[model samples]
Target: MRLRVALLTVLLCAATVNAQTWTEDGDAAALLPGQTTVGSGPLTAINGTLTSGTDADLYAIYIDDPQNFSARTCGGTSIDSCLYLFDENGFGVSMSEDGCGAQSWLTSQFVAAPGLYYLTMTAWDFDPLNAGGLEIWNDAPWGVERAPDGPGAPGPLAGWGGSAGGSGGYVIALTGATYAEYGPPPPTGACCFEDGQCQVRTATGCNSLGGNYLGDDTTCTPNPCPPPLAGACCFSTGGCLELTQPMCNANGGAYQGANVPCWPSPCVEQPPGGGWSDNFDSYPQGTVLYNVGGWTGWDDNPDAAGVVDGSNYRSAPHSIAVKGAGDAIHPFTGIQGGKWVIKAWQYIPSNLSATTYFIVNSYYQHGGPYFWTVELHFNPALGVVFDSLRDPNATSALPIVYDEWVEIRVEVDFDAGWLGTVWQYYGGQLLYTGNWIQGAVGQLAIGNIDLFAPHPETVFYDDLSLQPWEPPTPPGAARPLFAGVLYGGLPTRTTDLSGFPNTNWLSGFPFEVDGAAARPDGAVFISNGGFSGKLYLAPVEGPAIWLCNLQYPAEGLAYGRGRLFGFCNFASPLGIYEINPSNGSMTLAMSTGDRRFFALDYNPVDGLLYGYTEYGSPTGLYAINIDTMQMTFIAPPIPTANSAARAMACGYNKVYLVPVYGNEGYDMYVYDLAQGVGGVWVPMTHPFPESQSTGGAAFAPGHVPGDTNCDGAVTFDDIDPFVLALGGQAAFNAELPDCYWRNADCNLDGSVTFDDIDPFVALLGQ
Candidate 1:
């Protein structure tokens, strides 16, 4: 066993940045099995020569300590080669034949049971036949440190050991510790994890090597590559995102679990609902409904006509004070057709300087000079005034209670009953039901007809809405608000009223018909994305025609009284897009700061665009002013992880919402648009989760006038609710809400007032 050992410099062939300074050549036959020890040292480089595939160089080494053993072949000489390790008995231990782009390596565990190991090098194919050497190391974990040369960073120690007469930076010996605990330097292209990357490596190195190296002296332990850990995270805006848990929570999103997919969690489509709503709580008392709707003179009071006074309000925060002079006469947006129920919460001062009246200009009827008003006279002399719209010539003489909040309602028909019959309700009690008006209805104005300068009273009004009046309790979860259908089938703008009628007509596309918006022409456009994400011009009561493909899945879609708007996260810039329903085309409208919003709708009440999306810290309900693209946070974010999730609908003067629990259906929340963008979102009276899908909303068709029975007709059987109403029983008032007491006030007089006795008797005779 001749100990062939030497310490010297490596013969530089083409090692671009050569570091090996020593080497030794010993052919397999030259150092036959029994003749060993060609190289001996903890750190050494053996230079070997090969003439053919069978030619191999063998090195024998003795380990003093058990540590990880690593041997790598470095070169660019085009000699395909492999490194094999064997035990003292010549039994193979492990072998690695890796790719060599100037570097090839193999790492293995060293066991003490076989104290002696043999290292052999062979070529896969011989070409240039340049001599190569073996570099060995103790595999110290000292943080798995890499020698800045990373793959080509000058081999860790000199090619040979001190015993071979090597100088400083030479190898030393250590005892028994098999390598697994302290692995050698990793080859290039190896990965580092999120917190396990090197912290130091010159900017020049990182830039040149295509790795993140902040400075010098960086190693794999501290400046390692980031681990690829990604999944779904829910944001504060009810937006489910594909991000790491940390990124999700940091941006206000709740992590549902690990490995969650982004699409099924939702990344597109708009939910239904969005019109107008106001609780009069989100704005200053004088903040007129102008921003909410096209109205004027809300704060104008030069003549002291009116004021949005917070004091003496029936509804907290705000109510317009009518100091005579058509106070707060708001011209509501949109000319609603079909059946409309216009209702308002009002408060009249116990007494008045003269007489004030809340009127709906339903167009004059019965040959009257002005459109009729459901007049409720507070005058003790005039008595309990009711049903004035039915018989304007009548009067009452009975003392009636005043000075409290009261709701007054009226139904107007623009289709069959245009300027025809009108139904009035006082506190939900049907007061007048007949063809009462004669002209086309426009807007509403409430004030005193007798503008007496010495008047000593003011009228307070709040929560006014002209919504389609369907029965309070709809048959299903969602009652149809418009005549449009969901998108299905091919691209045709015609109605295909067939198949399953449960609102799932667009099952193939929307699968849910999730997002919806109404055109000014009363045409309904639905998408299968929220319900699908495809925008379409749908037929009323039938299937919808695909209009255009949304660039990205839209999380929210809304059609303003003037324009259509949609929220899309993948639409290039990730923002809102204005869709052309005529043809399926989209135009970029606004960016959402990369935030994912789930729903969008236009509220006719505040004339503002509102929607819900990822707040990145909380699920946020937001109102965006189109003119300034300014976003106003409406309320605190709703949590949506491991819960129902959140969905919203907008219309009338309210925003209907379903939070969390949406997966299994949850209670619906209604936010007043009058509350501006900060009012509390309260649950609606009913918990109908049926509307939790695409077309869910709060607008429904109103009862027809003259249908006192509200049975959709005026047959002889229509007298039941009226008869029950006269006696003040729950049966007759079933069609009304609490707070109403004028169901049978047929003669336009106060309840229990003597003036109604004669009229009642005459009506019974008929």
Candidate 2:
């Protein structure tokens, strides 16, 4: 055993020594400019260690033009020099040309196992004027002294001549010196000279001495660099422009100095309507309508049958007035040509049950005529039932007006639908609400016509304004869960029920469910098997009945920051919809798709929606710019194939995902908004242990103070079992025969440890 140990120790030392003596060689004369030799031979490793033979020292040698030595000049101009070293690859890893006029050379030592490696070299020309004249050799010292000259032989210093009287003869040399290395001199305290003088070592002294020397320490008087020239800007004549002092032409042509005293001319703010004017040529006979305080109006030539000034008419609050009337509808002219929500205020005094009315019209050059008009039928007993109309026929008239200002509003979606809501305000109190809905319309008009009365009665109108209208907030149940029914195979009999916690399950196999939406008005919408992707309506206390078969039904299912919005995806494409709790109808409102959307549980702290796709990328994580509708790539795409996102949950500002893929369990990824686009994904290290695969995850709906088991109940039976598990008297495994595993999970974290026991003790029997 002693002999074997000694042999092993000897072998180890030899191996270490052999590893330190590796060498790599290359022809430096063949190196090309800008190309770095990273690794070449099989043994030449770029970023690793190598082992080699004993008694071998590694070194590298290369050739470069002496004139190209801006990096480090070794005194002269010519093609010259070679550098060699052990461990060259370790230190010379970053070799490159120092500068334009500097030779490319590098050397460094390696602290790894030695190895023999070969490097390929290419020829490089530092001197643009002379090329292809340099030659390089390996394993040779540069500028070494040779033996004294003999017959048919010249000494190393034979062709080199020293300065007069030998003052510069070979500066300094230790004769017969072995292993002499040439490098820059040691740093001294700004006093040492190459010629060995302590003082008087300026260019003059070195020249007089005929030997190179370092310059003396003369305090450097910094020469001030010239200041940059001021910039100038030019402007054309008759143009309203501002000019600064520095930019002004001091000689003062049209360009003068600034308003300050330093340059002395000020910039002038040009007056409006000064440099240009409109040239009018003709005037036709018609009422020239113009907007006054941003209101709506009309233009018409009541006399000239063909000269209607509709082309140039402007709409405003105080623009045009109706002088002569005969049930005529004229377009509101010069209304800035934009989609507007028109509103009006009028008054009526009598409670007559006659058909009295007022009409407002919109004329679109492309889609044609559209209108919103109000009708009123009043009686002493029934009071008045007000109604609004869109595209009212010439003969259709109900009842309206008693010489009072009645408030009315008209909303028109350019390509979608039109809505008009009329309200009666009596003494600052709204008395009635009347509304009209038109699937599609174009223009707007406002006027009153006599139906049964002898002539038209004048109704005062005021406070007319055109402003954009915001859609009403959607109303729906707080949370709706649609359960799926599972059918047994081979016989197709109902065996179980599946609650699709995530929405993506709807895309798969022929699973059926009595689909329902819990309504805010205490109603529910259910669907029979008749319509594909259709839903039925039923009151919470009533029977389920079929409603309408919706197109692209999945599009009706939209999720937004903690709220869900449902509407007929195609029929009323732009209408706002909500499940009415009172009747369970998917009621349509006058509002459309112009609201900001976000996913549920969006983090205000990080400004990121927890589970919604920021934008639609295949990558499961979407960072949506809600303001811009731009979705940015967040993390790498989720690995589940053929899966769709179903539900998202948030806790501690991290978003959790419930995707619909096959048996590939619910994988969770955290939203690290801090890790911007293409950032690393942080996987949840500790997943829910009891989840076979996560179907969906959510915080318990209702709070229970001591229901540690999270089974929706709290009782004395939960305490003793939890204590027994905490005392180790019973195992809390899921398969354990007793209920300790269930009762001891007091914290509802799927575990029965100190975490579960402590919470149970605090709220015991509560």
Candidate 3:
């Protein structure tokens, strides 16, 4: 059989006394998690001084019951009772006990210096081994009373009607609680009791059994409780209340009466109203109070008393006020101008010279276009001066005036220097220009002026304008001329071999053989046939051969008016080829070569082509009609052993020759085509003896008429040489051609004379 342990109910009582007493309630039954209810009540005393105490104590007065339980198991699974005490000094204490079934009494004490305190009790299973019930009561000097009184008390002993069938129940009561001086404790294990109070144990372990129990009584007194001082309020065991003026609490301690006295607190006092003045009455940064509502203003008003419209002004106590004079009397003898714009409307006067002139002028000391004034002025009649301190001095005069309502236009041309203009105007009309009564008018003043006409002047002004002048323009830009190189010596060769007789010409299978003639039209022509060649015109100084192809020549060659006549030799037929000078393109002019043609030349005089045959008793020079392909013997060729003239050149109204061979050595001869006669073959007067052999020659195109040497200039050097050569007094020598007799052939007509001097001069440098 399982042993059964019955629940036990114990009724233990504590005997410790405290100076103050408080009661509390434990937690309500069936409360949810995180929910709590607090018990509250007023503390009433019985035969004890509740007014004063340095400490407080708490007690738990409650009932407990434990139902049937097994012999080995105690009914300790319900909530336990706990008590806590808190003081106004931020101190707290706590005590706990199992229900009346276990340790029935719980108490906590704390030091609380003559002030309000609070106590609390809670019921919970704080320890896993304890589960019981609780009921709380106020343990004051009065007997223990149930919370909420009588049957309504919250506990198992309150209005109970049940059978005790092996279930435990106990009723705990608190009594004999009072405040008094603590007495010496009885010996340990001593029991004591009082009316309606059960036996309780003292702090010394002495139990109170059936006697007047003084264990709950402790020392409590009024203890000099006073009121709070200034800047503090009275907060008592009741609640907090504010301290006001006159009702001062000078004792600076706690008080128990209503409306505890206090003084007007500095903590709640309003800040003082402040103002400042520049006069020595108040230095800068110094302040004073007016005790009035907020208002602050700076006054600089003068005696004239001008009103500033649309401005609201007020003065604040302790705020700074800077004062200056507004208008002043002028010392000089000129018209007085008033202050245009009033900076401030109120002012205080300094103790200084009152009669001193406070003249107003339109010049501001501060650098700006706004208007200001001065105390001195200049007069066109009596010069400038200032007023005396006490009396109007003889030097006192009216100040100069300016138009304030208009744009004061001042024009300054830096280029014009002093000649620039300075003008003032009222509206659009000009008021003053070049008429300034000049003097130093020092201080700006705006106020009343006691003059011959005593009256105050008020003026308004703004927006003065200035115009800056510019300088003149400087000169312009410049340009240059276009120029190019006209003519010069070019290298050429007519041979087929390389590196022989100079590499002026390139060698190939098919070779073009022709003489290039430069035309006055700024072009050149080349022939491309063996003997029956094609003529191609090319641009002057352009590439002689472009891409190894003749630009002009699917056609044949030609020579006629300002052109070369092309004809075939014994190997090929002749066709007239007109060459385009710009790109070397060739066109067929005419073709006729059954009559064998050998050489060609152009008559410089008539601009006609001369052709020659290879075989004849005397090779004849014939003029060809380029239009008709007809020919006439213009001149007989040279008497030569060979049959044909190999080369010919025409210039100077004559034709020159080169023979295949002659005993006279590369002989040169000229024939006058006009005379149609054979002349003596004249050797050219060459400048270099090494170059005397007659290779080939042609007259330069566009030759200046008197520049014989082709140097483009005529001079005495050409004249003297022709005079000597015309006299025939010297021999024709190639080494000294300039002095040779052949040089007289200046016209190159196979003779020399003064008539040749002209053409000699024409070809002098050439």
Candidate 4:
């Protein structure tokens, strides 16, 4: 038994032996660049075991051009390795040690005009009895050597030629170009323009983009020195014409910045906008179908057949073409849960069948158990099939022109509909929308899927990308402020709604409210931020009660005509909900696409809800139907630098904008609420100190009784208009408007806003 145990130990030890074990006296043979290579550099480490403190090994290589070079004992080994580089003449030209510190790597890339070079690897492993090996690269690709979260005490160093502090399997790459054209972006202020269609950009860089002669180090600050805003945006089909942001945003082409014409830039992600873009233009004329795994085929194999067609294309010098039915998939990151728009330009030379499919969010991997796959197929009879969710006999024809290049798109929203949804678009118009029936989970895979396998048709594709379809980041100073109507309490220090001479009518203490609204019964309702999911109701006569769970803590809440309305501005698409007054339950009223409403209030006069939408170029006010929830773009008249107002309260005829104090970094803008004047947010005086933070607002107008003006008699004369003007939102002209408030200042107060609502009702009762 003991002899068997000894033999077993010997077998285990012998198993670890192989090409991995480097011998000191082994052949000083040459090694190929990538044969033993790891991710970054050529492999030089022959899994060697250390003999003693004096043990070492050497390897040789011949180089024709001067290039960046480095060597290290990598692979998270505890080899306090020392490395040396010698010229052909045997002179030790350079040397490195645990220069990477705890990373225990020795690296140097300044090797030049190489003829013959020898690298010696040695380490100071305390456990010398254990097998030791030298793992290294000759020309290491630039990468973060050490990160705050990793071994070598460090920071981020990207690209090539940077040293790393972490121990890991590293490979080497060689570059002889004295100048680096693409590195980190040229300083933030420096303007950069790429893609035949670019946003307006100023011309200033180290050198012109398409030049090989280095030495162009000019800086272009597109802002301060604005780029030529006017320019022809070029499309992949090689179409070009001048257009601006608004035009570029809509036109199916690339919007290259100012001064840059379509002659050289690449066109990509036409019409649709995304954080990242590709036009296949970067591929040399003979490139092929490949994954990000560097030119691998659509099937993810480097040798997979495909072509970068320069002869027939859109946008630039190249587009991808598959001889037969082939697929290509792209991935995305940093996008939130909402709609992801997948777009691509495809040229199908021959006719095809409804069997020709395009897929979105398809994750049927390893061959079976299908996840959700939104497929678009061309069936001459059925038109475009919305894949899995197609209704029986429902033929929705997607018009596709053959032998021509056409753009196709699909919008996948994982956050809405009964089981998520897919909306297909053709020629900038929504073609069809289909809901997912099965597949509850999967990944975002956008590309081709052949439902009718082995179709002899070839499909050329280009400008494919997934863009985020969500709200613009809220305006710089826009914040949800709290405001509510008070029918039965004393104004407290915290719930002060006084814009000027404060009032005694107050809300039962505010609870750090971020949003507030009032029911028709005069009970004030409030919610803390959008994700809190909790709301409160302050009765007219008693304490505030923890109302039912809102489920969606909407940033904007309103009460009108016996119902509760709310706008939830969280991660997913902005959703509108109707809250039940009794139990605080919620029903998804609708989705406003990406339009984010900052605050809203129901207009008692028209029974319409008016509020601010901060999703477009400039923030604007919008009117929403109380019943249908259909929103009409009233006007984007507010010119605040970046959508500024966070909360607004409706008065008689005007809306009051409130600031969250410290949140805004710029001057507050005030808009004219009077009718006829288009909305323009002009800079206004900030009434509160910068430190004060207010969440929302409710207009409380008081009144003076018996005077003709607030004289108790409501009339259409200038006196009545002037008196009611104090009520706000009141449209007072020669013609009597419903908004004109009667300064029934029943309590003999000066103003006539909501504060007089109860008092006016009392007078009416008399």
Candidate 5:
């Protein structure tokens, strides 16, 4: 493989304007008095080339001013130039590799006593120190006396050898030096563009095209242009992207002010809302419906457009007709909570050739990472419509209804107690009812709805509606500060930090809870950590229902971005996984790689996923990339005698790690990510809640105390709401239905009462 190298040249401002050019004349001599001269005049540009791979160009230049000696190779063609500076006795003084983008430069190495010097350039991997029949680098720097013999350093001959077969031309720019010979300076060389593309062009032509001219003869083989700087660009919809400032600005994202990576992201949260209903009647007949009214084709392909047909209409004179590869999708955001019903009237003709799809994504990140919540395949040939993602084997027994308008209704309940559930019905008859298939169980959000046709199977859709339904919250199911599985056969428990050192357990769970996460509506999902890894929905009063089974035992569970993330061990390639909140199915979001993560959580404030990997080089907390699974070390490791994996959860700007097996019973550790990276996990200073070992920590959404209005902060504005909450739960719920009434318990005494009045006042003052 030919290594193409580029270089950077540094020229010191000189007084005398002497432009001396020395071209290689019949293989310049390797010793003293070879070809070029380095005097105290101006800059000397050396034009050299390697005729073949075995060629070596040695410029025997004389340096008058020893202190101001600088030799650099920049403009090159098909060459990875390696520059070496040697003393008069042929002892290597200094060598540079890729000093400036693939080129070499020697500026820091000063020549103590400048008499005669050999400035040699060669392709990479051709080591001068080893080719001299001796390990010169091992003898104290690259200082070994060796004289050049010819193009290929023959056996036992002290000269440049091992020419890794590279034929290229290069221009060496020298400053504070002069050469004896003079020739026409080469004008055309490699020009680099901003996109890191190189093209051979003249200095004037290159500058005209806004490209950096790498002198006269630089190769465009290997890209040497420095890459553009990128930083975290945060979006209002809780999305963080790493992009250049220009790109970020173009996309209307707030740049994080520097080249900051997305991990430990500097992004701050904004507001959120997304959902839409559309009827094709508004569009003109035969119009391409793709990219119209937020409805775009799959992957934004304009060719896969749905035509608004006026012939097949269910309620009006228009409906979107999809055929061939036509796939239409309408996206939604922040639709993960409560129960949602998606209704659309579809007409599939009897002449359908292949299958069609009605899909719903739980989480569809702007660019990708689509988690399928519902994928109902309608196979006209098979005369069946089935839920592919959830119950693929069980095709709905109901016969396919064709040639008529049929209402396709899918009811999805993400906040259905613990596990998100979905119900599909076609033409008023039940088709499928099961857990919503998604990455994680905690987040119950739907990203978008897709209508697709695989193979010219014409399908018509009209009058689509995606709306939310209010599901009754189970009694006694209120927000809790802490929820985890107690060790030593103790049931799962819920507690509040408001009472602090004397806080009592709010409720004892019905079953074994190893890992747990809470939905925004205060429903908690707990898991049993064993070989079976059974997961359940822990209701406030009723018995917990078994949801699904996990492949591996999970100690920590987290809820964010409408999904539940788990730290699953007891399996090879142990790492973080997305636990389907509806079915408990697991999808490997990211492998731990080399480290082992014990806990995981999602920070809403920064819109970043966090995990803890103990006992490794990067043994500490990390911000994980959900797409790439790359781990960025953020905080130091949690120091403990027993490094057992535990459950983790996030609240506001804080991350709480639970069931830390310390000298005392299990303790909780809290780390404030707002404190920035390198933050330490400090033991909770307050008194302990549950005295047993626990795992799978969880915090109810918006669980801050004294924030009766649930505005995320305790201020005087909350006084009215706090007074209402103190009056009665029913009255408070009627007024502030969106706010968590438990937040009025400012005293952390686990209840809103007269005792919370003073603490509320204190919080207001603060």
Candidate 6:
């Protein structure tokens, strides 16, 4: 019996040894395939083991075609696995989890070209890509040693809450790639020089030439070199442009050091239009607020000082709170003329039963003699809010919503003085519009704001700002034609529609946009199609604003009637919903029974909402009467086997549709409504890049050359508007508020000036 047992044990040991084609070294160094060479013209099965919970097995492979390569861990015993692929530069190329049940694989398109790469197979919770605050391969250049997030201190990657099981055998199946043989580096590899140039050179040659050597077998088809840094270039006319240092010097503009942006326009010596903004995020919580961070106590009294509170905040973490005898004061400078807007986000707790005042003073001295230009009171006990500056004693009809964040805005036309209007708004709704001063008030300059908290009920304030205000331009105004495309990784590209096929890519977004609508004011409203249902307003000249959520994926968006509307294909009573531009609140405008619209746009010329559908009943180009949810079919369905509909837009008496599939070149179809033929959709030439996933499309209004008066003609009546445009954009906007200034650019040189007189005259002759 003892001899039989000994024989069985020996047999089991031999079988275990035979199965392990590769074994762990129990260190950071990677392992190589034990059975087969990679890229041997066929798939190879490599066996490895995770000896410990922190154990990770990294295999070096050389791929001839990265696109065809596939790696997956199948039938691993007792192992919850994670897989990662990195290029020769150690940058992440692909990652996968759960490709095989409880194991990992790379099934998606790889993000690298043919090259030497690393394939890492780690235990469930181990992620080398997320090294704890260390300079890993993700952040460093080639040849730099990166800190590994592994079986040591600082532990495995954080935030991944997957399986914790570890220490088991793993089987890796690899194809379209080969095991890398170690030796001296390759004779020729891609090298990058300081001037952002790339060339193939030997390791020794690259070192002597002061170039960065990528690795053996590396190629430069995609150009691995980084581009040169760009900085602000200042012109004599106080115009700032961003360009590389060499380009700036060539253009004869003074460079403003490296990496400096042109935003906030550093060329201006003073605050542009004189404004101030403070979110109070920089101040420490519970700190005394006397003479700190441009904030002082009322009447310079230390006992009556406010404190930075963390208990309640709108913007997050911290906000200024005031109670009895805790008054906060913030002063302003260089704010005198024009229409100045003061805004603050206020939060009042539901438990409050006392009154508090938000005061704005025109003439304020430290000790005495304060002229309160505006005084707004919040009284949750009385269930009402009112403005003391209203000449006829204006009060709010709506009750104060406690425990909610509300925007308090006061628009003061200091230029109008006593006759100037004081417009107050709460929660984006106009509360009152009255005299700026009650009776013959003298001073016009805005001096300071006093947070008067005489009662014990605490009131919090955050995200304060004082800046010049401009009224919103009405819809359908002439401006640069722009379009927005949603891409992966939360970056949306805003492209100029006028430069289609060679479009100018403007800004990036922070979230994945599912639908977009371009405004004539050079702004775009974007929505997320995900279940989160978020919408955002991104202006060309200002910061993006979170408007509101629609509670459903908005498949398309359009701007018309001075309001934003979203099309929802999959919602209860699915159809279009009218969205308020100011607050993002929405209401169902109409319902489309049994019809699904994939994309939507509004034609200003016809005053109809244009809708498009790729498949299903009523599939074609149609016009929707938003008031009644009725659709008018315009054109029959077109071929869509090679592509799918992405977005739709209407302008220039035409309807445009963008179709895409698998990153192929961008193809568009346009239907001229003026034809009324309902013929096949005509293809238009455009230059959209290949492989980018498109989500939405929109059209910004463009000006007609020589139509300065915006009367839709090049007649003699446009002469005066053209002359006013020559004075400057501000002057033209003031006199011809409804006219597009760029219409005066008859020469199409991007400006209105004396040089355009000849072209203007030619248009007059025509």
Which candidate wins on TM-score? 5
Q: What root-mean-square deviation over C-alphas does model 4 reach?
A: 24.5
Cα TM-score of candidate 4: 0.28
- Ten-residue segment with the worst summed lDDT in candidate 5? 1-10
Model 5: per-residue lDDT, tens digit, 1-766?
A: 1111010011323334656666564355544434454333344688777766666677766554567777777555447766766666666666666667767777634566645567777776565543435433321222222233322322222654454757678888876454432233436788876544577766755774578888876777676567767666664233345556765665545688555644332442212222357788788888887668767777667777688888878878888888887878876544545677889988888988888888887544344435576888887767888887766775454577889888999988765543468889988998888777543221345567889887765789989987766642222223456454445433344555655544444333324556777654454667775767877654332234455777777766776656777777776667788888546778887777767666666665566777766656867777877876667888875655554546677766777776455335545677888778887777653212423455666666434677776646888888898889989878987776645677777776545789989988998888
Candidate 5 positional error at 646, Å: 8.7
Better model by lDDT, 3 or 5?
5
Candidate 6 C-alpha error for residue 759, in Å: 10
Task: Report the C-alpha lDDT of model 6 over 200-228, residue by residue, as the tens digit.
Answer: 87665577457899997798888898977
Which run of 10 residues does model 2 get worst, by summed lDDT?
A: 166-175
Candidate 1: tens digits of C-alpha lDDT, residues 685-744: 222222323332213212222334432334555455555566653554454332122424
Question: Each candidate's lDDT (Cα)?
Answer: 0.44, 0.29, 0.29, 0.45, 0.63, 0.63
Model 3 residue 652 CA deviation (Å) reads 2.4
Expressed as tens digits, the lDDT of each residue in 1-766 for candidate 3 is: 1111011111112322332232111111111111111112211221111111111123221111112100101132222332333332213322333334432232222221222333332332221110132222222212211122222222222111111212122122222222111223322221332112233334332221223323443211322112323222321101112322223132122233333322111121121111111211122222221111111111212342222212112232222222132332211111112112211112212222222222333222111111222222222234322322211363333333332112222221212221122233222343333322122211111112211112222232111111122221110000000001111111121221123222211110111334434343222344544323344333221212221233333321223344444443332234545555423455555554544444455554565666555544344666666767666655555555543343455554565544434333433355666675444444432211122222222332331333333222356645543444455643323322212233345454434456776566555454
CA deviation > 4 Å runs, candidate 2: 1-552, 555-563, 566-619, 623-633, 647-652, 664-700, 704-766
- TM-score of model 6 relative to the true fold? 0.34
My TM-score estimates for the predictions, one after another, are 0.27, 0.20, 0.23, 0.28, 0.42, 0.34
Predictions ranked by TM-score, top down? 5, 6, 4, 1, 3, 2
Writing each residue's lDDT as its tens digit, candidate 2 over 558-605 gives 223323334333434543344432233555432334321112233333
Please report how far candidate 3 places residue 271 from its true position, in Å: 99
lDDT of residue 171 for candidate 4: 24
Q: Each candidate: RMSD to true structure?
A: 30.8, 32.3, 55.9, 24.5, 19.7, 27.1
Across 3-114, the per-residue lDDT of candidate 4 in tens digits comes to 4334434543444322222222222222211111111112234443334444444444433334444555544356555454455543344555445663233334446554
